[model samples]
Target: MNLTTTTRQRWAWAFYDWANSAFITTVMVAFFPIFFRKYWANGLPSEDITLHLGTANALASVSIMLLAPFLGTVADQGGIKKPMMAAFVTLGVCATLGLTLVGESQWQWAMFAFVLAVVGFLGANIFYDSLLVDVAEEKDFNRVSALGYALGYLGGGLLFAVCVLLTLKPEWFGLVDKTAAVRWAFGITAAWWALFSIPLWLWVRERAPAQAVRPSLPVLLRQSVGQLRDTFRHIRQLRVVWLFLLAYWFYIDGVDTVILMSVDYGKALGFADDSLITALLITQFIAFPAALVFGWVGNQWGAKRGILAGLAGYVLITIMASRMENAQEFYLLAGSVGLVQGGVQALSRSLYASLIPAEQAAEFFGFYNMLGKFAAVLGPLLVGWVGVLTGSPRLGLLAVLLLFGLGAWLLWKVPRD
Candidate 1:
């Protein structure tokens, strides 16, 4: 591809981050847990609510974790990454739109819709991450990966700001109340996801595989299963990738746990909903600039070192969070999270991209995403079950420190490039 064309494709690929992030920021991170606890499952005990929400997230992660490797293999073999992403994006958008119809005390229906949306959100990412190699040269991975995350932060934050305003000032938008505004936010999220995804579909092009084929679905399934088994053995031989994934599994779990559960944790401590929402909004905007800076950090210091620095920051943040007592402290913690969250995630992706064989990008990234989803499975359940058993959300939050500490130790052992 010519330089002008290649640059356009890279930006187009990055914009998918902008597209899907609205769902994550508006629906998943800020609104869903808040609405689930205060609206849908209003009368339930706090621990029970935590358990239910965690279970929904875990279920979605498990589904994606089980299927990502196989699906990745199929996408690589078929050269159909865009088509696969389209299917999941449709699923996620439709499920998010479904959230608008769920009425009060319908936590089950709410959970059902939330689960499907999460599945769609994460499933699309497997193909999305794999496309990094297609859109940018290997040497540009860190910069390009960070650009996607920075745009994700900006795009997700912008939409989330409007969604937050809709809740805070429903009259301004001609909505009936906060409940009505929340429902409207879900619909808006779906629309934003679909609208921004169009650029990716139209502009970003997938690289044709070396041995592309047009096998029927049944035949593709059979072949992919066999390929997945072989790839499993193949991964074992790639010691650096294997070790790095093990490290990512733990640190990213801590990261995902905090993102998903922080609002609920603040609520359990008696903080108001407005405070929790504002704190989260602060993180999104702060993350926008911080993500870009980390891309530069990855370039100057190396991806592994950049990741290690982020993990150290996370370790400190987690510890401080366990002792946090007020809204001001929550905001401080939120800002700290923003500083490290995107940096860690962006660098890890670029680092892995540098390590994997380009020809197997989809299949290898499938394994990467699988471990990420599996980490999601463990992280939430760990927090949820511990909160239920210990009757202390603080203790549950503190438990995440172990994952970060362990992950950092292992990451240190990986030889730097």
Candidate 2:
């Protein structure tokens, strides 16, 4: 691709982040927990609801962890990354839009929809991430990754602001009730995802051409299995990459679980949905500029150093969050999270991209995603188990510091690109 074409394609790819982030912000992070607790689990005990949600999340993570690598391998070999991503995105968007039909009496349906959407969103990211190699030169990977994250923060933040406004003032939008307004917000997320996904489909041409790799289904399966085996066998040669993946797996778990579970944790401490939503909105906005700043810092210092600084901040925030006593503290925690979350994640992706081969990017990223999903199971389960056992979220929150510290140690050994 020429410079102009590459720039346009990169922006188109990044815009997908802008597009789908609304679902992540409005549906996954901000509103879904509130909807679950308030509307779904009306008669059930809070503990039971927490257990069920935790179990469902764990199950989804395990399922995705198992499937991601296989799908990534096939997509890479079959040259179907773009098509697979589109399918997953469509599936996720439809499932998100389906949230509109969920009602107080239909909590099960709502949870099911949420899980389906999560699966689609996460599964699609495997291929979406693999596209990085197609769009940018090695030197530009970090900046481009940062730009995508920055765009995601801004896009998600903008929609979150709108959703919060609509939620706070449903009557202003002529909605009959707050619940209906929230449902409308979900509908808007779906529409936004679908509409924004169009630019990538229209402009970012797929680089991998489909060729007839003739084999029966069984043969193809055997080949994929053999390739997986070979990849694992060769993993020793990729020791640095493996170490980075291991560190990323654990720390990102802490980051993702915190983002997903913070709202629930806040509610358990008596903060209302409005407060959590407002705090998340702050995170979204703060993360936009912070991502860019982190990108510059990564360029100036190094991705590893940038990630280390972010991890240090995470350790402090997680500890403080464990002891938080008021909504103000929650807002402070959210601000701290915004400052580091995108930077850590963006630099991690860029760092890995620099280490891996372009042709194997999808497969490696699939393994990366798998480890991430596998890690997702740990922090939440530990949190739920500890909270139930100890009757305090503080102990659970405190345990996350171990992950950060361990990740930092592992990261220290990863040689900088």
Candidate 3:
């Protein structure tokens, strides 16, 4: 690729993160979970609400784990990354927009909508992530990956701030109710994602040429299965990489669980919705610059070292969060998360990008994503289980420290190169 072409492709790829982040911010993190628990499932017990949400999320993760590798292989074979991404994004956007129809009386409908939206959101990421190699040289992957994540935070945060303002004062937006305002936010997220996805479809061409031998569906299936088997075999030879992945799996599980569950935990502890929302906003704003700083730091100290430093931050935050006594403290803890969240995650992606073969980027990223999903299941399940056993959410927060500690130990063993 020429200089101009490379620059355009990189920008297009990064913008996908910018585009879909609205859904992640508005629907997944900030508004919908609260909406689901409060209005959609009004009659349910708190435990049941938690369990149902957890189950829905877990199911979505499992579905993505099963499908992502095959989808990657198929995309690689058919040269259809752009189309696959389009299909999944449309599926996600439509499902998100459909949330407008959910009512206080329609819990089941809301649940199904959420499940579909989550599947679409996660499935779309498989193809989106695979486009990284096409966007930048190996030497520049860390910086480019960080740029994408920073844009993601900024874009998501901007939309989330708008949604928060509308949610807090729906009358200003000429909306009759807060619920309606929130519903409109979902619609906006869908539209935002759809519009931003257009550039990549139109401009960014795939780098790796498709194989000449196009197989039948049955043959494709057989080939993908064999590819998966070979992936496992190949991983066995990369012991250092495998170890780092295991470490990443555990630590990222803790990170993901904390992000997803912190709002609910705040609600349970009687913190106002505005307080939690403000904290999330803080994270978004802080993450934008911090991700770039982390990328620069990773380039100097090495990605693994940067990741270890972030893990240390996680351990400290988890301990402090476990002891929080007020909403103010929650905000403080949220600030800590903002400082490290994007940096850690972006560096991790860049590190993996360094280790994997360019040809196998999608297939290996599929494995990476699956393990991350599996970790998602484990972290939440453990937290929920611990909360049930101890009868205290604080104790469950402390339990997350174990993941960080274990991950740090394993990460320390990884070679810095």
Candidate 4:
């Protein structure tokens, strides 16, 4: 019943990032693209696979965005951020584990499970993001956020490396085959995610206004709707935050699209799956320190400047991606992505945390996350559309340049805090 040390609480809070990221790096970013296309959709056209994945991504984002505001509002009203986070984390872990049960012929079930895991991972993040205010001192926010992301890169990258070895050399792991290794990767990811989540659940306090009375479902529904409307109005009134949201929406679209599609892009170019996996590994490993440095940069130069720098780097990275030819060049692109990916995301989180009122952290983070979820949906669809239309993923990647441009331009309008 004793409280954990502040340092312990901070580390524990950040460990959640370390925990759930295995699913992201291993499943979503690396193996899943290959698994879905080559395994689940083996007989289907590549275009069909692209369309289905895009649709699934959009649907998951939509569902999460719709509920994020209400969830945030209720968690704030009831002081239940910790418990809600726990529930979502559990959902994510279970869904990931479910993926292990899906056979290669069961693309439908695979997609269903994948969606549930994404929902759980991203949904849990709504509350987890809010907790930044609770766990970090004002001055340390950037560093803490950066460290979370840095460790996330390290932790996710380490597990993914193991998965890579298991898949590439199954006999070394005593697995029957690569397919079995892949299935076991799903279970390993789930277990890793679940195990690392324990610290924050036990140590981090949920700081929210206590609910005076528990409401009926109807009453809760009405309150949530009203809260959403009020939030919409309130957001429009905050010019800097509004402008930042607009900017973030655009640039982050490019970022999310790139992360989601990079492996698929390589596959389209006929790069071997092993090469793509190794390239992704390069990004994850290199990003660990790069993320921490960005945090330090934010601390010294301010988060705004740090984020803008990252955006500029991404603009270059996106343009370069379209020109990538073979595996070596792909590895170069992956490493470039590593240098900015974690830093940009971490800086953005801290920067937004600085702008919002701490008292309404969860509620406001809800709106923030909704905008983010909406952004996630936009990027992939645009990529898919461009790919389908031009018959080239290179052209599809070219489409993301505009997103970064608009995001940077809008971001410039927001004054530094």
Best by lDDT: 1
Candidate 2's error at 315, in angstroms? 0.3
For residue 149, give model 1's deviation from the true position in Å: 0.4
Q: What does candidate 1 score on TM?
A: 0.99
Task: List model 1 lDDT by residue over 1-417, tens digit each.
Answer: 899999999999999999999998898888999999999999999999999988999999999999899889999888899999999999999999999999999999999999999999999999999999999988899999999999999999999999999999999999889999999999999999999999899999888876656788898888888989989999999888899999988889999999999988988999998899889889999999999999999999899999999999998998899999889999999999999999999999999999998878899999999998898898899999998899999999988988898889889988875
Q: Which stretches of candidate 3 lie over 4 Å from their true place?
A: none
> Residue 391 lDDT in model 2?
86
The positional error of residue 282 in candidate 1, measured at the CA in angstroms, is 1.0
Q: All candidates' TM-scores?
A: 0.99, 0.96, 0.96, 0.96
What lDDT tens digits, residue by residue, belong to model 4 across residues 204-257?
A: 876646557767767766776787688778889999888888888888878888
Weakest lDDT window of 10 consecutive positions for candidate 3: 206-215
**Local accuracy by lDDT, each model:** 0.92, 0.85, 0.83, 0.87
Choose 1 or 2, whichever is better by lDDT.
1
lDDT digits (tens) for residues 1-417 of candidate 2: 578999999999888889988887888787887888888777777766666667667776887899888877777776778888988898899999888988786778887888888888988899989888888888888889999999999999998888888888999999988899889899999999899989888887655633466456576667778777777666558888899988998888888888878888888888977788889988999999999899888888999999999999999898899889989989999999999999998998888889888887777888989999999888778777778888887887787777788888988988774
Per-model tally of clashing residue pairs: 0, 0, 0, 0
Off by over 4 Å in 1: none
Worst 10 residues of 1 by lDDT: 207-216
lDDT of 3 by residue, 366-400 (tens): 77777777777877777777777787878877888
